[model samples]
Target: MANAASGMAVHDDCKLKFLELKAKRNYRFILFKIEQQQIVIDKLGEPNESYDDFTSSFPADECRYAVFDFDFTTEENCQKSKIFFIAWSPDSSKVRMKMVYASSKDRFKRELDGISFELQATDPSEMSLDIVKGRVF
Candidate 1:
């Protein structure tokens, strides 16, 4: 129930459940956005990786719109917690989210999107290209 649009990082058990659902059906790859101003998916792939291979893996330009979910309970109450779905977009950066998902991870749901990124090897200073909010989306 968290970041349903993109995908959630759940515990190993939760991950199993998620994978089960994923394999069961082709729900929807609703396009989302990059919530983070900058993301670094350093493993862009191998030395001779082809562009199509990269895209097949996950295009650097593509992104998923998502929301965060949180709860205040310690353990027992945790079961009541969840961040539900809102919508998805291939280009979340193009627009501002219309709603807030929740607090904590939920707090970040509408704040922004996430992306894969890497520092410019030639200029690690990041001044030349840090992938700002306005550009890459």
Candidate 2:
């Protein structure tokens, strides 16, 4: 449903798919995009997909929203995982696209209840594995 305040709506499938990822380990990541004024699922990553695969999914000049089920090892050797909500507004993307994605991010994020971390990335370097790991620890 569309949020009146942001003039954007997140499609129902987005939440359903996220639930599968969050609960069932059904996906590695989900790519989201704005189409027809609504947020929709653009792609799904396989459970075996690597972080590099997830990062490669974005275009160099577009804005997107994504959720990645990140698995990591703690310093103590514990296996841990976190769900990351990423707002990707690449520097080369259009100004309007960036604004709309930024404005709609909160509204859209509200639909997915279990996100563990949120990252707003303008450059690919900002969300790199090293940076993400540093933030998590």
Candidate 3:
């Protein structure tokens, strides 16, 4: 299917969800939880990924968290880190999705933006969230 006047697909909600708080029409939309979208947060080299696990599982949960400019075209350039999004569950014993982020490149290239991501939490007892998860797409 397609939009009435636009040529875009009609069923790409999930892909469109990644959109930032941008304005496209005469009105504006505000999400109650903006931290769950593909918005940018910081470039402060996040807290070293919490690396507290020695037996964490592979293929762990990797949400497309944080989108850096990374304009690698100058000598004074450096890797930047931004928060952009969060998906953490406030009431979970395990390391829940506190937030998520991704690249400005839209690496996944989904029609709708992604919310918080989830992994199996293989070693829920022996992993630090920064280490167990926190890898952006």
Q: Which candidate's TM-score is highest?
A: 2
Tens-digit lDDT string for candidate 3 (38-107): 2332122222222222122122343222221111123446543222332222233223333222122233
Candidate 3 deviant stretches above 4 angstroms: 1-11, 21-79, 82-120, 123-127, 132-137
Single out the weakest 10-residue window by summed lDDT for candidate 3: 25-34
Off by over 4 Å in 2: none
Candidate 1 residue-wise lDDT at 95 = 34
| Candidates, ranked, TM-score | 2, 1, 3
Per-residue lDDT of 30 in model 1 = 20
Clashes of 3: 29
The residue-by-residue lDDT of candidate 1 on 19-124, one tens digit each, is 3323432211122333443211222233344333422443233333222121224444443222222222223223332232112234333333231222211121
Against the correct fold, how does model 3 do in TM-score? 0.20
Q: Which sequence of candidate numbers ranks them by lDDT, best first?
A: 2, 1, 3
